[model samples]
Target: MTFFAPRDAETSLHCPDCGTRLHIARSCREVHMYCPACRAHYPLREYIHRADEAMERFLENVYCDRIE
Candidate 1:
């Protein structure tokens, strides 16, 4: 079978204001990281979404590789 999407890769999140790319960093139990684009920061929810998406793709890739 053919695979789609990046394997275990982080999603490139762009800033809404300046279009600067952002990376997710786990802060404290309360927060995540800074937005380079808007300069307005966000919470863990955003990190969770990105992390989950990356993790899912990661697992899928590992499984697919093993199967082949």
Candidate 2:
């Protein structure tokens, strides 16, 4: 079945300016991110990139035993 609204996925995005956790909803079409704390809208790509970077850092720490 086809859907109109965006698909819900678990995501943890932090505002680059305020460090506030941001919510994400993915869609078949393009979508942008709006941060209420900072009153700014960021491209979806930017949010994804940030998320990727964060995950990479976390994995590195875990593998290197930096996190306990």
Candidate 3:
């Protein structure tokens, strides 16, 4: 579960590992993300914490929060 705000709904975000779009689950207490493209899991915010740590920020924002 996550503690994302309602504003997170309209925001664009994605997973750091697979580079797939992600959704904000308010029911969650922390920011958790996953990439359908690669089926990888990672912590939110930290997704883009570094350059070599994950994919490009632009690519991560591609399908961010567009799906549930």
Candidate 4:
């Protein structure tokens, strides 16, 4: 069973390894990019500059408590 549902990145970001589109997924207190084909995870910081609407929303929820 999965706890969180991952959202597809709205940008045209491609995986470096498998050349597959990446998905924005979040764990308890963090968010990152994941490649389904390669099963590899990337740090959010690496893609923040290219974040899309979905990524923005996820970031807001993840950091809401620290915003103030």
Best by lDDT: 4
> What TM-score would each prediction reach against the true structure?
0.39, 0.44, 0.30, 0.66
CA lDDT, candidate 3, residue 19 = 48
Candidate 1: regions farther than 4 A off: 1-11, 31-33, 46-68
Candidate 2 displacement at residue 47 in angstroms: 2.4
lDDT of 3 at 43: 57
Ranking by TM-score: 4, 2, 1, 3
Candidate 4 wrong stretches, greater than 4 Å: 1-11, 64-68
> Which pairs in model 4 have colliding backbones?
none
**Superior by lDDT: candidate 3 or candidate 4:** 4
Q: Which residue window of length 10 is worst by lDDT in model 4?
A: 59-68
Query: Tens digit of lDDT per residue, candidate 1, span 1-68?
Result: 98564312334566555667654443223224456556656553544445556444444434222221
Give the alpha carbon lDDT tens digit for every residue of 26-46 in model 3: 333444555545666555455
lDDT of 2 by residue, 1-68 (tens): 97343333324677788877655443445345556667666666665445554344333322222222
- Each candidate's number of clashing pairs is 0, 0, 4, 0
Clashing pairs in 2: none
- Candidate 3 error regions (>4 Å): 1-11, 16-18, 24-31, 45-68
Q: Write the per-residue lDDT of candidate 4 for residues 24-43, one digit (tens) a residue.
A: 87667776789988888998
